[model samples]
Target: MGRYFRRKLLIYGVTFVIAVSINFAVPRLMPGDPVARMLSRNKVANPESSEAMRAYFDNVFGFDVPLWQQYLNYWAALFKGDLGVSVYAFPASVSSVIAGALPYTLALLLPAILLSWIVGNSLGAMAARNKWLDNGVLPVGYVFTAVPYMWLAILLAWVAGVILGWFPVAGGYSFALTPTFSWVFIVDLVHHWFLPFLSLFIVALGGWAIGMRNLVIYELESDYANYLQALGAPRRLVRRYAFRNAMLPQITGLAVALGMVVGGALVTEVVFAYPGLGSLLLSAINNQDFFLLQGILLFIVIGVLVFNFLADVVYVLVDPRTRLGLEGGQS
Candidate 1:
């Protein structure tokens, strides 16, 4: 087991390095100069002042350095836990910018993914048993899964926010209120959160439900199920066994879904002007904020790799076949 984990760790480490290198390379390869954009936005009129500003920006943004040297410096800074200051949000560290947006993204995504998976799996498992439920819920599940996430978000915003005026159409909270721990602030936060959360939850639920239903049905019809039935095992016991076994794939799916939470729900944020990483990411791109973009991508990469590693460990623990293979290899 130790050997297997060491091997996995080594692989993950290599993948992380490669992913980081790619993330660093992409922004540099893109067209347009970030320094130029910053100056343009600032609009320095006098040529001497413009020249002074240009040189200052060049020094601040490391445009004065050679490409190879900049790349090396990037790695060194990263090792020292420096993500650099945001070019667009000048004077603000990349870490701080990302930190500010992290909460909204998490608040929007975590509940959506978790609740959807739990509800979907339960409903799907039940659907396999009751034909009436299977007939009724399956179509609804299909519609939810098939709908585009952004499209659903827009529809919900229009119907609920625009027409019914049930919720705020945009922003993480009411702009009129200051952020605080008071009940008023909390209520406003949930009011704005509902549409985005619902869009994600409703969309994700169908996929989980459909996948679980099929897996449960298959497990019930598998040879082991028949053998247990022939031996007169109680229906509940047989079903309990099948359900436990059927959960393996869902466990894996859950991990991937969780891993994606950091990068997930981009469209929903865009639609609602939610104060999250997705909105921040758009701003970063528009202004060619390389450091900020790199930081966001790095965050996403680490999240995915960490969760994937955990999933592998969990799968080996729960699935006897995987454990047996590793054990046999040691022999």
Candidate 2:
């Protein structure tokens, strides 16, 4: 077990290194000068003196800093947890910018994700039990999954917020309500959170429903299920037997999905103007906030890595055959 864990750790370390390196390279390799974009809003160039303006442009866009030096500086700052200052959102550290916006996304998304899994899984179990339910739900689930989330958000916003006037159209809250920690603030916050949460649920629930449905359907066809049927097992026992076993495979996907909560949905956030990590990322990129972009990417990479590893560990726990296979492969 120790050796297995050590091997997993080593692999994760290597993957993390590669992911960070790639993250740095992508922004650096882009055509336009990121530094210039970063400074464009802040630096006002006077056209009166072409020479002075030219010099300013050169200083911002034509710097000949060695790639190695820039890479070294980036790594050093990352280690120190200083992702540099953003030129776009003046004087705000990339870390601070992300920290400020993360909670709103989490508050809305975390609940939606949890509910999707629970409700979807239950619905799937029901569908698996009743063929009529499976026939009814699967097509609807697939149709929703096929539709783009941004479009769904738009539709929902129009129907629920515009025509019905049940939800807020945009932003995290009503402008009238100050964000105090009082009951009034809390009530307003929940009221505001409803639309984003609804958007997230509409987008996420379809996939969960389909995935759980497929897993349950496949489990129902297994030999164990047949044997249980022959033995006249109670309905609950049959369901428990099939679901418990089939859930092992589905667990890995669910774990990885949960891990991606930090990444946020860029299109959905943009459509709703939701103050989440996804919106932060879009703003950072538009303004060429390199440090902020890199920080968010690193956070995402680390999250995916940790979650994937946890999934593997869960795989081992759920299916002893997996550990046996790993042992045999190692030998």
Candidate 3:
């Protein structure tokens, strides 16, 4: 187990390096000059002043340096936790801007992903055992999983926010309310949070349900299950084993979903105009804010790598087969 985790850690470390390098390169490759965009947005009209400001901005952003030096500086600054200043939200550090939005993204993602997985897997397992439920759940699960995230978000926004007027259509909270710890602010937060959360939850729930249902069915029909039943093991005992065995892949899926939380359901966030990393990323792109975009992408890359590593740890803990396989391979 020690050797197994060490190997996994080494692999993840290499992956993180490659991912960060790509994240750094992709933004620099994007068309247009971010400094120029910033100057234009700030309305720096006089040519002399514009030239002076451009020089100043380029030096400050390290754009004056050669590409190779800039790459090295990026790594150095990254180690110091300096994500650079945001071009779009001028004068604000990229870290601070991302910090402001991180909570909302987490609030939307964590509950939605976790609840969907738990409920979906339960429903799927139950459906596998009952023919009547299988008839109803299978098609519904297919429909829910088939719906695109953005489409569902739009449909929900229209029906729930527009037509019914049950929830606010845009923003993380009511613009009228100042952010505070008061009951009024908290309630208002949940009010705006519900629709986006529901959209994510509903869409994710179906895929998990369908996957779990199929896995459970396959496990129940596997040779071990048949042999157990032939030996007159109780039906309940056999099914319990089947359910546990079927959950392995679902665990992996849940981990991957959690890993992607930092990406913040990009299209859904755009549709709802939610104040999260996804919306921030869109703003960064539109404004050619390379620093901000790099910061966001960095978070996403780290989140995915970290969560995937955790998933491997979890698999080793939960599944005896994984442990046995590793042990045998080592031997």
Candidate 1 TM-score, C-alpha based: 0.95
TM-score of every candidate relative to the true structure:
0.95, 0.87, 0.97
Pull out the clashing pairs in model 1: none
> Where is the poorest 10-residue window by lDDT in model 2?
54-63
How would the candidate models be sorted by TM-score, starting from the highest? 3, 1, 2
- Cα deviation at 150, candidate 3, in Å, is 2.0
lDDT for each residue of candidate 2 in 107-143, tens digit (9 for 90 to 100): 9777988787777777777787788998987887788
Error of 3 at 215 (Å): 0.7
Report lDDT (CA) for all predictions: 0.92, 0.76, 0.92
Task: Summing lDDT over every window of 10 consecutive residues in candidate 1, give the lowest-scoring window.
Answer: 256-265
Higher TM-score: candidate 1 or 2? 1
Which lDDT tens digits does candidate 3 get at residues 74-96?
99999999999998998899999
Specify the poorest-scoring 10-residue window by lDDT in model 3: 256-265
Residue 150 lDDT in candidate 3? 86
Which regions of candidate 2 deviate over 4 angstroms? Answer: 46-64, 227-238, 262-264, 323-331
**Predicted candidate 1 versus true structure: per-residue lDDT over 174-200, tens digit per residue:** 889999999999999999999999999
